[model samples]
Target: MLHALAEQNTPEVRKQARRYAEQRIPLLRGACVPVSKQTPRDLVDDAITDIFLGDGDPWDPNQCDLLTHLRGAILKRTWLEIRHRKLVRYSPFDLAEGDVETVLARERPHASRGDISPIVFASMIELVATELRKIETRDGPAQVILECWQVGFVERREVMLLTGLDDETYKLARERILLRKKYLPPRLVAIVEDLLDRSA
Candidate 1:
């Protein structure tokens, strides 16, 4: 099964594999202490051990590197009692003001001259803004966006769309996509629409 998954090249297959890995890899929370018979408890514990301790043979090497790392981390990570520090709270809108064009240009030099598509950069900005909004509303922490980026969507395009790109880009969207609005905060609009769409 691991070998098959490792060799999987299709988008559909890899997407399914990503989803399976995320759903299957969960922390062992509450355990049923088997008092009468240690068999069931032992079996469950060993399975957990196999997953956390052993080399990730069940994970696809190419597609499941993150999964493998997470598994190893669960077992091998040392407990740290470092003092917690407050997160840098800034104007959520400040992220939008940070020279997006210059930043994108600096980070992706190929993006200039329509080489990398301006729409794609816009989509990323919108996505980041969406996460910032979550922090503003107390709906969830800003960290959730990073977490979702890590484990939820398999494809980068899928993530952009999930963040309300709708089409390949906001400009491609039929109606006045809030994401494409010049004056309005694209990230905030995307966040509201994304939440509303989910509820609907």
Candidate 2:
């Protein structure tokens, strides 16, 4: 039906698209966990557009029915959007003004009078950044991903889109970064581990 509709430009096809979108709105909304910046209707519309006009993989009727194929596409797009929202909004390194103090207090509870200097915290962050820069020297994607993170674009798809990196390159760059983390300062590692633990 989609292939046939793609060959024609008619009001009925447009109406059918709208009807399909309307019917899937509830399903999209339910599947879009944690809510996304794009509404369910928007996702449905975009999926319809991709199926009909985008250069994505052509829908295979032999593999699945239209609604089933649409459900898969809508869910995939919705999850990607949700993941983007989560990554953009939540960064382990985004230490607000007082967050550093809280971390110091927790990590250095035995310190003399809880007077951990902010300079120490700042240096830890810089050390981690420097280590990442070292990794960047070997992997261009590492640098691109870091820059993207600094500017609030951390989702895999968005990072790939912005940097024009394919999946394999991005995965390898990430693996390199993760591998380099073992060489980071112990204090920095401890701090990151603690942050991850708390976030989890």
Clashes of each: 0, 0
Please list the residue runs of candidate 1 whose C-alpha ends up more than 4 Å from where it truly belongs after superposition: 1-15, 18-53, 56-98, 110-200
- Which has the greatest lDDT? 2
Against the hidden reference, what TM-scores do the models get? 0.21, 0.39
lDDT of 1 at 66: 38
lDDT string, candidate 2, 28-141, tens digits: 222223323334446556666777785455677666555555556665565466456445543345344655436555545432232222334455556667777786455688
Candidate 2: C-alpha RMSD to true structure equals 13.7
lDDT of 1 by residue, 1-200 (tens): 33443344346543443444332211110011111223223433433344444543344355554334333333332101011111221123223335554444344433322122333334455555554344333423223333454554524345455564444343333222223345445543443343233323
In model 1, what is the error at residue 160, expressed in angstroms?
Answer: 26
- lDDT for predicted candidate 2 compared with the true structure: 0.56
Give me candidate 2's TM-score against the actual structure: 0.39
User: Where does the lowest 10-residue lDDT sum fall in candidate 2?
Assistant: 26-35
